[model samples]
Every structure is written in structure tokens, then in C-alpha cells.
Target: MGKNIDDYIDKGLKGTPETKPSERREYLSQLRERIILALTNGQVIQQKPYKPISDLMKRYPSSKLYLDGDLDYMHLSKYIRIANENNIPFTIVDDKASSTNIGLVLANPTAIDKDDIFVSREEFQRHL
Candidate 1:
């Protein structure tokens, strides 16, 4: 049985002819061209719009809002604007001590501290 298996493997290996250098090169060139064409004419991917945290707050009014320390400024600004407009209170807490500029927007008048700078929705609109 071992001898028969060995003969079968040898027959299978010998049946396929090795590709010539020129033929191999031409085949590779064609594959490269196809890949380049596919890449150049590829479909344009569309990104979904960013959903602000304030939108979520509107849906769930009592939900606690916690912004990540590493979030993009533009995205954060959108949430801040929405929160400010709707009088939704939000706290920006950073677990990392290195992040000194953690933003905290308080809509509730009672929660305001002496040191905290108060900015009304009208002021935010004027700046915009």
C-alpha cells in the first residue's frame, strides 16, 4: 500500500509541467496590472455621520454623560453645543491625571461652583 501511494504521488508531481521564466514573468505582470486597475477604480466608501452625545441625552434625559479623554475636539464641541442649547448638564471627567483640560458643562444653575466660568446658551450661540 505504501509503494502504491508513493507511485501515485510521483505520477501527480510529474504530470504538471514547470512554468518557463518568460511565461511566469508575463503572468505576474498581468496579475499586477489587474490589482492596480482594481485599486484605481475601486468604489468610494461613505462614512456615517457622527452622533452627538446630546442626542442620546435627549432620548434618555436622566442618563449620565461621560466623555472620553481621548475624544476629538470637533466631536466634543458638537456635544457641548447640543448640551448647552438644550440645558442638559454634562460632566467631562478624565481618569488620567495628565489631562489637565477636562471640560465640564453644567446647565443646572444650582450645580455651579464659584471658580467655574458660567456661559449661557445665548453666549454660546453668539460665539458660533
Candidate 2:
């Protein structure tokens, strides 16, 4: 059909379409619904790791950790250590093409539709 041909041509010309490109950029290439936890660059840079993150990793052992490759490894290493301790797979997303304020994300491959994925600074501090 003409529409099918157009679709194929479009795909060839523009590459495959991505869902919620902006959201993915903001969440370090993961969908919002799939994220179990997200931390801002500032949060990740704190001297201590967010306390609940370790527990969350234990709760969702199958989840993957996405760290912003833009930051130095020292800023990200605490969480990386936790991921290693929990056996949660981790990735450093070096998305030079896009800029994001989010420095870390813990997410599943499938959508979890979690409503409270971001931890407020107050809650994070209290947990620490």
C-alpha cells in the first residue's frame, strides 16, 4: 500500500521512530514509567549516596542502573558500588547528543508505571 511504502521510506530516511524521545533524554534513555528511581546530577554528587537506593536495589534486583556518562566516575562510583553489591546491572549512558539533568536512573526493561519514581531531597536526606 502507499501508506506502507511511505512508512518504509520514512524509516529509511529518518531511522526508526522512538517513543517519548524527550522523556528518554531526561531519564537517561529510559522511559519514565520504567524507572524505579531517578536522581538529579546534584543529588548524585552528594558526599554520601542516597540511603534508600541500596534498599531499592535489593527490592528490585532485576532492575538496571543507568548512570550519566557525562559525570566523572568519582561522582557516580558510590551508586556503582551499590549496584555491584546488589548484583544489579549498570550502564553509563554517554549521550553526547542530548543533555540531561538526571544523573542516575534505576529502571526495569518493562513499564512499571510507578507514580513516585523521584525521591525528594528531603526524603533522601532523611533516609541518609
Candidate 3:
């Protein structure tokens, strides 16, 4: 006879130990490297837009929005308008913030120009 579903569930319910800080740091470093390689090799990373400008501003009151240099003019204008409406400060910068508390990154690969020298994920990590 096959094992009951409850048996499998019971086994799965046994939680594993949490990752140590050092191990987590190493894993994150490796993940960062992989992402950088992918970006440098012409890969695009699509991040899901999660929060509204107002919510984000409220959460990180001190954060400045760093707009990518190659962002589309129309989108940039829209973001600026939204920021203004929400009373959030922002700037166009070559580098993105490494820490979330300091700044928010807004980059759209489709909006980038072919001739523009876009910063790679690796460079951003180094700045962090």
C-alpha cells in the first residue's frame, strides 16, 4: 500500500533550522554574482512593482528615488509627477542604492537606450 498523505505532510511539517548569518551572507554574495553575470550578458531582470509611490515614501521617508539615466522620458516625467504629488524627493543618478533605506531604484530595460552606458548589477553591488 502507498503511504498516506498525512504521513508525507507530517514529514514535511518538520521545519529545518534557520540559516546562520554568515551562511546567508555567502549565499547572497553568490546570488549577486550570478545576477551580475546575467545582466552583463544582456539579460533583463523584471522586478514586479509592488507599492505605490505614496506607500513607499511613507515607509522610507528618508529615501531618495534614483532614476536610471536611460529611463524613458515619458516614464521619468510620470515618476516625477507622482513624486511631486506625494511630496517625495528624487534624483537622476548613475548608481543605484545598495541599501533599500537610502534610495529606491527605478530602471526599465525597455526604456534604456542602446548607446547608453548602463551600470551593471556588479557595479551596483560594489557600491553597496
Best by lDDT: 2
Assess every candidate by TM-score.
0.30, 0.90, 0.34
Per-residue lDDT, model 1, residue 82, is 63
Write down the worst ten-residue block by lDDT for model 1: 37-46
Candidate 1 per-residue C-alpha lDDT over 23-113 given as tens digits, one digit per residue, 9 for 90 to 100: 2233221222111111000110112112333454465454333343344555555555665665665554444433322233222222222
The TM-score of candidate 1 is 0.30
The full ranking of all candidates by lDDT, starting with the best, is 2, 3, 1
Over 4 Å off in model 1, which ranges? 1-55, 97-128
Clashing pairs in 3: none
Model 3 lDDT tens row, 10-126: 668975445353422332212221121112212111232222445655654554445443444444565566567666676754433221111224322122223433345555344
98-125: candidate 2 lDDT, tens digit per residue: 9998999999888899998888888878
Q: What is the lDDT of residue 79 in candidate 3?
A: 54
Q: Give the better candidate number (1 or 3) by TM-score.
A: 3
RMSD of 1: 23.7
Candidate 2 colliding pairs: none
Q: Report residue 60 deviation for candidate 1 (angstroms).
A: 2.1
What is the full ranking by TM-score, best candidate first? 2, 3, 1
